[model samples]
Target: MFRTEISMLAACALAGAAHGQNLADLSLDQLSRIEVTSVGKRLQRVADVAGSVYVITADDIRRCGATTLPEVLRLAPNLQVARVDGAQYAISARTGTDLLANKMLVLVDGRTVYSPLFSGVFWEAIEMPLDDIERIEVLSGSGGTLYGSNAFHGVINIVTRSAGETAGTLVKGAVGTSERFVTLRHGAASDAGAFRVFAKKRDAENTQRASGAPVRDASRHQLAGFRWDGGTPQRQFTGTGEVYHHRTEDVLGERDYHGAYVLGRYIEDAGGRRTQLQAYADRLVRERSRTIRNTVDTLDLELQQQQLPTAGMDLLWGAGWRLYRDDAQPASPAALDLLPRRKYLHLWNAFAQVEMEGAAASRFTLGLKAEHNAYTGLELLPTLRYSWRPSEDSNVWAAASRVVRTPARVDRDVASPPLVPNPSVRAEKADIAELGWRGRFGSGASASLTAFAHRFGQLRSFDLNGATGVFANNYGGWLRGLEGWAEWFPAQNLRLKAGMLLQHPRYDAAAGTSPQPPSVTLGNDARHLFKLGVAWDVRHNVWVDFHVRHVGRRPAPAVPSYLAADARVAWRPAPSVELSAAVRNLGEPRHVEWGAPATASLVPRSLLLQFVWWP
Candidate 1:
């Protein structure tokens, strides 16, 4: 049945093309029109944003044949995405690429996903139905002025489709060499609102160690979620909730985790003024190992307002409050423990940004954020930006900002076999500057280039005092880099994109004459990175997508440089049915992307077949 349907579509497309009816071409203007909200915390044209930003659209996701969020992220050339195993990934931007990359912030529909326990994301535990995602906005620079602390390097925001747009039934299934997944979704529309519910399950096999042994990293996960949207465009209300359970078996032992969250949002626009209020609550429990367990609960509330107070002037402001309660314990005496078995943390923040048109075809933006955290009494983040449009198709921008990464629970409270608590640890800070240019040539080409520099202080390190190790802020560093990308469309049916990155990173002790501890190490720093992608619409209903990436050798842990390639071919038999096949890591059978002692298993080449049905 599937083959027949696809064959029918192929024949139709061939017939139509032979009749001189060409498919619509995707122009540069259309691509630039995609609006993004992560840059300034409000909707803005992608071309108008004064930062290094990239957008992964729904079409890009479908054509890439990505089964996980990190796989989808690989399309963004500005980001460094590495797979550690079947379920774990390490992702960052510009700098600090490691297993625990704490400087980057990640959010799903305005809800933060970074765990305060370690200030890093547990990628394995965060799962969502990929079909529901509308777009992902990636900003490769500091967003501290608007997002507050921990936005020191970059920010990623994932947006989902509106319930009204997904009013139907969808079922999808996939089987691959290493994993199997299934998803079901149902949506409905009523006089008062639109709602959708979805569920997904996945199981993955283990990977092989460098020594050619199975790593025992198999995993399984299940997730369910729902979303509801109501009211008119002028007065809208949204409610969403999700729950998930995951289990994994690794070298250490078996681990289990489960979590749930609910969010409510209300928005109103009257007389050219817009207001938004949001609230959310979440709880999580994790058995990290056989002898370690932790539980956390969080409640957050926020209010925001946006308006065009005057011609050529735009302003947005918001305030938020968050509370976190945590409980941790060790089942065995040899396991790690928190200084306080139970603890509570409070956070309050307010932020504002104003944009105004200046003389000489330029725009200026000023932003500031004031935040108070339990560990850091008070902190201030500020940014200034200027953008100049020399022509209708070109833009030049510059910006400067101050950002910080606050101490996490493990930094100041952890006490275990190898880590000792240190109450004196301070926040890591950086002063960043950037300049960029973006241009569009004719209707078939576009390009962007950015250069950035950063000065850091109060970097985190370990202090060994006669066999006991304690965390401290005793190191500093300087980082400079260049990132650029170009896109070309030689034919209406073909599109190509290429990107490159180069960086120089250095670190040293803040206090002269003090030797660095052996435990203190900089993250995986790649000096050069390159990526190329191609998307060809073979026919009106068939497409082929291919990507190639080359990562330079990293310093610590010493991962040799490697090149990887991925390809996917997809066919849409009807408006509601699709079939696709994909191959990943085609360049090498198995290779390690990260990890020392070579603990991380090698990422193996895999092939998958997928089918999607919507009615």
Candidate 2:
């Protein structure tokens, strides 16, 4: 496989040998100047960030030919993403995969979307037109000091383009063996502001089980959203809203989930000082039966400020408040249900960070945060970082941080047969250290490498007593990993990107705990992952891209290692229209990326045709 990838790259290079300029020249330049805010809570050049971070640009998204957000995220080497079925994905950073992944924090345009019920994201419920996405930043280390709780392992921040940038009409559609979807969007400028509205509908076929029998996982999605941006550069105001309905069929029967949210943000920049205020309201409803339903409502508010307190120094501070109200109803006699069906969860946090520049292109940063939650009264997170630039286009950085994950409702309030929750369960904690380097070898090539180690305490576990078990904090472990990625132009019109991950995790159950191994209870994670991609400009108007990835075997659930490949070809028949064809899971016909053997859904090779028109 490695030789095959190398041969493909060599072939692309030879094909583009006559071109004058490499396609990666401009991209490499833009990458160095790309500003990211996830690390310090303020805009900073990628080279200046003191932690491991990967940025996926808009151009990459356009060329990738992916229909869903999760598919696009595969470009980030720091992340581990697996498709569970037609409409579900298990994603994490620096760790293996989990259907109920809870440690990673995800934000869409500054709005948190993870459910408080399980402290995990319901990917099917979060949908938006892909064209509006500007960039995605994947931070592979802890962001507890600035991002507050649930940033235990990593953070994914999805930023959308400003309304003004999308001032036109766009129609997109796609047909595939596994799914079909269409989207419509229109944007215009009025006296109030620049605004755009979009609507999308999609349907997916059920996946097959290992035995070739169809599973009950088919789904349908309907989504609509709008964004409006107003005011001047010195004082900007933005408002956004979205509503969605998702329906899924499973063994239990058909279920419908509806969600809606409204958000507003105001920013003031004056005299080298910036201040931002944001607020949002969100609601989610899931209907199984007339009497069995789950509903969650949330209200969030945040304030942030950035200033150059003195020469060669930067200061940042922020505070946020969020409230989640969950009303749940048990489905049947054996379901694990939250006691006191209606309950409220409140979280408040404040954080401050300071960066000081030193001699010889070096910087030092210190950050601290204090958060108060319903389950954990108060938690303190602190971080220290240093970065040194050895050359104009290279950076060496190191960071150490403390992060905590507070207990979710499932951990503290559940009361059901064969399971019991303990309100006394403490928060899960981890101390992480990271060292990384990012540099450009030349104008046409760049690479990033990071080494990280984590020491965890009070990890989630269970204590079996007689006939039932209670949630407890009796697991601790050490996890160490190395992540590396590189992109280069071997020819003027060809670009190659590759990445790999090596992870080692060791966990031990505390004395007197259940005898089950930690891997069996805590979920299984793959130890190695590799990905390679190629983009070749076959002609001025035709482009082709190829991607191949490998995932190592998992132990607990006993899933064997697998390799998958994908390819896309795009043609621009006119300036305003594009037509493309994509094949996913190529070469490998049927394989399972997750779940137990008997019930796991098999992902099959499929092809799609897509069209986009701008008028």
For each candidate, C-alpha RMSD in Å? Answer: 5.5, 5.9
**Residue 547 of model 1, lDDT score:** 95
Q: Residue-wise lDDT of candidate 1 within 156-249, one digit each (tens)?
A: 8888777876778989999999998999999999989999999999999999887888888899999999999999867888899999999989
Error of 2 at 433 (Å): 0.5
lDDT of 2 by residue, 4-33 (tens): 011233223322221212354345666567
Backbone clash total for model 2 is 0
Alpha-carbon lDDT, every model? 0.83, 0.83
Which portions of model 2 show Cα errors greater than 4 Å? 1-25, 190-192, 288-292
Worst 10 residues of 1 by lDDT: 1-10
**Every model's TM-score:** 0.94, 0.94
